[model samples]
Structures are given as structure tokens and as C-alpha cells.
Target: MSPSPPLPKERRIRWGYWRSMMKIELTRQNVHNEFAKKVELISGQNLFACYQCGNCTAGCPVAFGMEVGPHQVIRYTLLGLEEEALGVNTFWLCASCLQCTSRCPKGIDIARVMDALRTVVLRKKERKDHVRIPEFPEGFLEKVPQIAFVSGFRKFLS
Candidate 1:
């Protein structure tokens, strides 16, 4: 038999007092360049390259397990929703296998872009107390290998 149909893209709180489906109300004032520009600079991938065809998400091995897939990450990143993109499991769960990059019609290196996003959020001084950056803490540092240690510094450090 065919696999069961997927759930709807949007959802509602029918039982609760909240009656409307969740919506992203994009205010004109909220749109800004700070986040997306940094991601593009770090990844060296143009946001203009993406046309939202969902190829990256479809080819991702871990997409099924991610709270946000590669495509949504790109969309959210471009939309300047840095917190939303950074807060998701998509970047952490990515295997860096390059399946999404290889399959992209836009020739975007989505995996690298995800890494760039990770770098931006992890390196933010203001966010340190809230998130556990894998690079920090003495016990965590010594246990992590040299390659990982160096790579983390290179990726996240300015």
C-alpha cells in the first residue's frame, strides 16, 4: 500500500481558546539585512540562487527527523528570522553528507549555509547563556577531538 498521506502544512488549536491556525505575520519593520547578509558572507552562497523548489529538503537524509528542513532553513534565513532558523534541530541534525548540495538545481551548498547559520548564532556573545555551544566548557572541550576543536573555532569564531 502507499504510505499514509502527510499532515497539513498548517495547524490549528481547535480545543483551546486559540481558534486560528498559526500564521507568520511578517511585519515590514521586521525585515532586515543583518542576518541573511552574514549567512551569505560566511557560506559564500547567494540567497538569490534559491528559488524554493524544495530539492534540498527532498534530498536530505535527515529531513524526516528535522524540525526544519534545508528548504525551510533557507527560506527562514532569507526572511531574516535568524532566531527561528537557529533554534531548530535542522542544523544540528545535518550530517554534512552534501546530498542536498549535490541534488540542488540552484547549485547551492545548503549544508555549508546551515553551518554558517550555526556559526552566526553560536558566536553571538549575547546568546551564550541560553545555548550550549559544543565548543565551550573545559570538560566538553578536552573530550572533543582536536579536529573538532579546531573546526569549531574556525567555523564559529570571528
Candidate 2:
């Protein structure tokens, strides 16, 4: 009947088309090489296991002052914006109280991530201007030896 409508033309499937689509999507999303690798490294914490329960954010003491908060920091890292993640004052201001880590549903050591970010920032020569904590506070260097001895004595007793 009417040659069965000439049998509808089959849609062409091209592997190259799929690849190009993927590339376009990634680029549109601002995803790049550095972000990919950084996400993989940070995922070692099993953060992908996180379900965004918000416990880490709720428990973080310095979350109020954070540019992106702990949860968003993890997300930024996962997205490969390592410099953006580490550049936040939150990384330096963290109290390291472990509350976020302890409360994490995925059991991620958030404190460890913070420490790792700080280490990365410290090792970068370009980040010297980003140093938040002074190596020696005013008048503190003059009493260094005395402070060291007292600290060492306290440690020995403990």
C-alpha cells in the first residue's frame, strides 16, 4: 500500500558524532584536563560515595566564613578547580577539629583534604602572597627558645 511509505529511512549512527557531542558537552560545562585529574585524586577519599547529606557542612565550625563551605569545596575539587578550592580562606582557617570528618556519611577525612590543600598551597612559589598565617607573629620570635622548651616539657610530661 503506497510501497509501505517507502520504509522510513534509518537514522545514521556515527561514532564521531557521539565523540564530538561529548567534547562539546564537556567544554560547555567548563570541564578541562586539570579538573579531571584533580577529581580523580580527591575521589581517593571516596567522596563520590557522598550523597550530599550536608552533615559535613553542618558540623564544620568555620563553615560560616568559608567562601564555598566544606561540601562545596569538595565539589569544586571534584570539578578540577584545584586552585579555586585551595585558594579559599576556609582551607587556612579550618580549626582542624575533625567534626566534619567524623560526621561525614561517606567517611571522608575532610580534615585530611584540608591539610592536603594547605600543603599544595605551601609548595607553590606563586602562592607566597596567599600565606594566611605568619611564620612568626609579632614578638613571638624573640621568645622562641623559651616557648620551645616549655612546649617540649609539656609534651614530655604528656
Candidate 3:
């Protein structure tokens, strides 16, 4: 008899999940494949190529401070876990230093992927508070050039 063909990742995960006898139900409706496709379209990077090697996370300087880290962010995006991916502080915490991107064996441009996620979240207005341009006190504002505030907001909000 021939061996069974390998299951797709989503199915394999679900199969293992059922074997574990977990009470949680897998919600197919919650996943939107278009999100992943859009990220690839905008970033021009194949994020699905990432195999969870953790190289991105290992080389990330700010990984210690990130709630989800670099690899998890990619995995979440690849799996189409939109809410879970966007809910974390990973994108906000990313320094865009490109360490993860450079070291990535797949040349996936992990930084761009994170930026794409943030852009989608911002565009959709899904999280109103994702990247707040904090209002500086009037006193501090007066001391600094107006351009400074604008530049700073442009830098961090991206």
C-alpha cells in the first residue's frame, strides 16, 4: 500500500490539534487569505517562504522587548491570523534595522513584512491606537521646531 500524501500545513496543524483533544474549535471563517496575498503584493516579499527558522528572532536586537518577536510575526501573517498578529507590539517595537532581513536565509525582507502588516492595520483603522502620535505638552512643543514633531511622527508612525 502507498503511504498517505502529506497534508497541507493548515490541515496538519488541525490534525495535531484534534489529536490533542483540545476543546477549542478551529474557526475557518476567521481566516482571510487575502491579507497574506496583500502583504506579498505591497512588500514584494514572499513571507510564506519563512519556515519559522527563528533566525530573524535570533538576530533582532529588540527581540527581547517585543511581545511577539520577528519570527512569530511572520508566522502569524503567513497563517492569516490577522487579529493576533496586529494585536501585538512587534511592529511598533521593530527598529527597522534590517538585521532580521539581512540574516534571513530566505531573503524574505522581514522588516518589510512587518511594515506591511502595520500599514494594513493603519489603513483598515482596525486598531485606532496602534501608533498614536502622542501629543507633546505645549511647553515642550514651543521649545522644538514644528518640523521636529512632524518628522518624529513620520518616523515612528510608519
Candidate 4:
């Protein structure tokens, strides 16, 4: 005889049990750095608290467009892999819509973390604006709506 499929309630219980039993530990020797400190200060989040569960990435609406998912970025940051953390377009693609924050089981405000990374990237003296107003063609700015131009600048610069 074929086995019956699990009921919704039973499925939920099994899923919860599975989640509770899973544990991920950080194995890297170096876990702290100036970059992580800066991110924690700016975002008011403990980078080490994230265990790479990927709930944030799973819920992010813009994750499809990101070069790296939010959870991976957090892992990179915690590991002091600044180049890996900052090199991806994950933070840039974040909509700041709070979806990731809402889905994080650890109560981490991941949107704030993305914002912090953006701030760090922009504040660096060597990094130039990915898109500068002065670099745009004169007619392009005039043709674009004021709100669009302002929002673009804020997204790329701030």
C-alpha cells in the first residue's frame, strides 16, 4: 500500500522540528575586523549573531537581481572578507523595504545592514560615485523626471 501524504499540521510540526535541530557554527579563525566593526556601529546590528540561516535572503524581494544574497553578505562581513562583502551588488540591489528584516528569525534588521554597507562604500575616499550627475548627458537629466533624478542620485550616492 502507498503511504499517505503528511497533513498540513503534521508537515508544519516536522518542519519546526527540523529547523530546531539544525545548527550552523562559524569555523573561521578570524571573525572580527575594522570593516565589521564599522558595519555593526552603523547598522546597530551584531554581525556575529547571524548564523547564515538565509531567512533574510529567502524573503528579499530583490534577491533575484543581487549578485550575492543577503545571508552570504552577512557571512562575508562576519568573516572579515571585506572585498567579498563589498564587491557584490547585493547591498546595492536591496530595496530597503524591510522584507529581509521581517523574515529574519534572529530579529536582525538586515535592511539596515545593507544601508550601512552602502554608506561605507560611499564614504571611502577612493571610491567614486557609481553614477554621477555631472557625468550624465545634459539632455538626459532635463528629460528625466525630477523625482527619478533625485532618487537615482540618492540610491547611487547615498
Leading candidate by lDDT: 4
Sorted on lDDT, highest at the top, how do the candidates line up? 4, 1, 3, 2
Candidate 3 stretches greater than 4 Å from native: 1-32, 126-158
Q: Which ten residues in a row are the worst by lDDT in model 1? A: 12-21
What are the RMSD figures for all models against the true structure? 7.4, 13.1, 9.6, 7.0
- Per-residue C-alpha lDDT of model 4 across residues 58-91, encoded as one tens digit per residue: 8888899999899999988987889999999998
* Global CA lDDT computed for model 1: 0.79
Local lDDT at 154 for model 4: 65
Best by TM-score: 4
The digit string of per-residue lDDT tens for model 3 on 61-134 reads 99999997788887777667778888899987877889999999988998888778777777774445544535
Order of candidate numbers by TM-score, starting with the best:
4, 3, 1, 2
Each candidate's number of clashing pairs is 0, 1, 0, 0
Worst 10 residues of 2 by lDDT: 149-158
All candidates' TM-scores?
Answer: 0.65, 0.57, 0.66, 0.69
Show where candidate 1 strays beyond 4 Å.
1-32, 127-158
Error of 2 at 94 (Å): 0.7
Q: Score each candidate by Cα lDDT.
A: 0.79, 0.65, 0.77, 0.85
Q: Where does the lowest 10-residue lDDT sum fall in candidate 4?
A: 23-32
Candidate 1 on 110-142: residue-level lDDT in tens? 989988887787678776444346646668866
